[model samples]
Target: MSALPYPPPPELGWYDEDATVMPQQTAETQPAANAQPVASAGTTTAANPPTTAEIAQTTAQPTTASQDDDDIDWEGTVLSTAFTASAPKQEYELYNEQTGQRIIVDTGVLLGRKPSQDLPQGVKAVKLDDPTRTISRNHAAISFDKDGLLWIEDYDSLNGTYIIRDNTETKVEHERMRLQAPCTIRIGDQFFTFEQR
Candidate 1:
């Protein structure tokens, strides 16, 4: 399971691979410079930036997908897989227990502040409203796999990601964790419950 690669965070946006940055500078503070400051990825140089050819190969769009549904007005995140008539089709409803908000999810979802807006072809992301500022820009992801299973993946967020069920709270570890409906998902202070539709 290869996760998509997004630009580091807004705090780190000032540092691009081409615009060199001095080693003494940190993410929080930057001084005015006449020349564009480039960020060095260890030995990376402005002459040779990393290419997205590798990323595109890994996160390519699926050959077959359904975009006819407009009831939810949001297309599910379609993972790269072979779609077949025998594939199981299951939809889940993500409800905000606190706000009574309902979100119907079938394909996959990238949850954070504002994801994919910057990426030209990145997977469309669902914006998570977090005035508390605990969630990262690309905080977590929910993907329905080809095998008809749901998985939750954490993006190494600052605070953390977790799943709670049966009165026991379990953290979403580094790897993607399998998720069952009728459970609560916590990204930072926000909480949402999922049930099969």
Candidate 2:
């Protein structure tokens, strides 16, 4: 029998009539005509994304003040005024036992070695200058809460803060404790008495 003839080899050229040519698809290339483009990570799709005109319109709109007169709640204001009026009208006085100096704390008081210039609007600074330098520059603070209750907080003092009540001394740090009248507060070697006036 005669040997079978081999098929012809494929044409190798830029333009081959019988060869099937396919375009390469790459990340940098545009998508096919009928293929839907994909959105990258964290990117919004064109189907529901905001248009440039909409974004510009939103940005061009003028902003009004958040607190308008019509938005005020008169009932809430009346209730707040009533609560404040019912609260006690008591004041506290801090007297240094050793130095014989007094500070009348109407709102709040900050006790330290040197006077603090950046104290809050209603807070007073009382200087406790010691010859031994045991007290910190910002040692302690005394404030009255909304309910007219006194509170004492130690401002991370080196020697610590002590509250002496009824012959007992309790060290306080980091947290504000309820301070009663006729109690002594000891910061380093200086002692101050909190009395109600």
Candidate 3:
């Protein structure tokens, strides 16, 4: 889990010493006790209330701002050891056999020589170190579906993409295939291993 960047503390003597500061702001923001609340369909209130039809009409109004559950800040008790506490999110990494480099996979990634422009947001585009020109501009994509599963698909590359499991090479020709950890992924000629931590 990434921690959001918070604003730095104010510098020394930054606050105005002469300016009047209010201790509370509730008085300005609070609604008047006698003010009647505007209602939908008609002038509703505590006394008259609203009919079932009126309630339905108000509830059917279109929502402009929809919030995703992941964007919401959640507070809870977390039991974590020293090692796990530092990295709160479940992480997956790709170990390149040729380059001997480990790259962290967040959401999903696109491994290619030069990444394509037509990529969805939150998906990383990686420039592979392919000296043989075996990898395509957008060779293969590690896709993340809504069901929280990882998948690999070939983007009609000249060579091909494959996933090896139990020494059996399964070609990802056109259709996407589910990718499990501790398996070798073959993008063109280079090989990479997918592992979870």
**TM-scores for every candidate against the unseen true structure:** 0.53, 0.56, 0.53
Cα deviation in Å at residue 71, candidate 3? 28
Candidate 1 global TM-score: 0.53
1-197 per-residue lDDT for model 2 (tens digits): 99999988655543433235555768668667788768775455779696788678778976544334324554345556556564467777878867887888878888888857797787888887676688999998888877878888999999888999989999988699888889888888888887888
Candidate 1 residues lying further than 4 Å off, grouped into runs, are 1-86, 118-123
Q: Looking at model 2, which ten-residue stretch has the lowest summed lDDT? A: 66-75
lDDT of candidate 1 at residue 99, scale 0 to 100: 56
- By TM-score, the best candidate is 2
Model 1: how far is 43 from its true place, Å?
Answer: 81
Per-residue lDDT of candidate 1, residues 1-197 (tens digit): 89889876655335443235545767556656665657654433567665687457546855422224432345565645675333477888877766566777776788886765663342357887776788888998888766878899998888788999998999997799999988988888888888998
**Any idea how many clashes model 2 has?**
0
Query: Alpha-carbon error at 21 in model 2, in Å?
Result: 84
Specify the highest-lDDT model's number: 2
- Which regions of candidate 2 deviate over 4 angstroms? 1-87
Worst 10 residues of 1 by lDDT: 63-72
Off by over 4 Å in 3: 1-89
Per residue, candidate 3 scores C-alpha lDDT tens digits across 156-196 of 99999999989999999868998889898888888888898
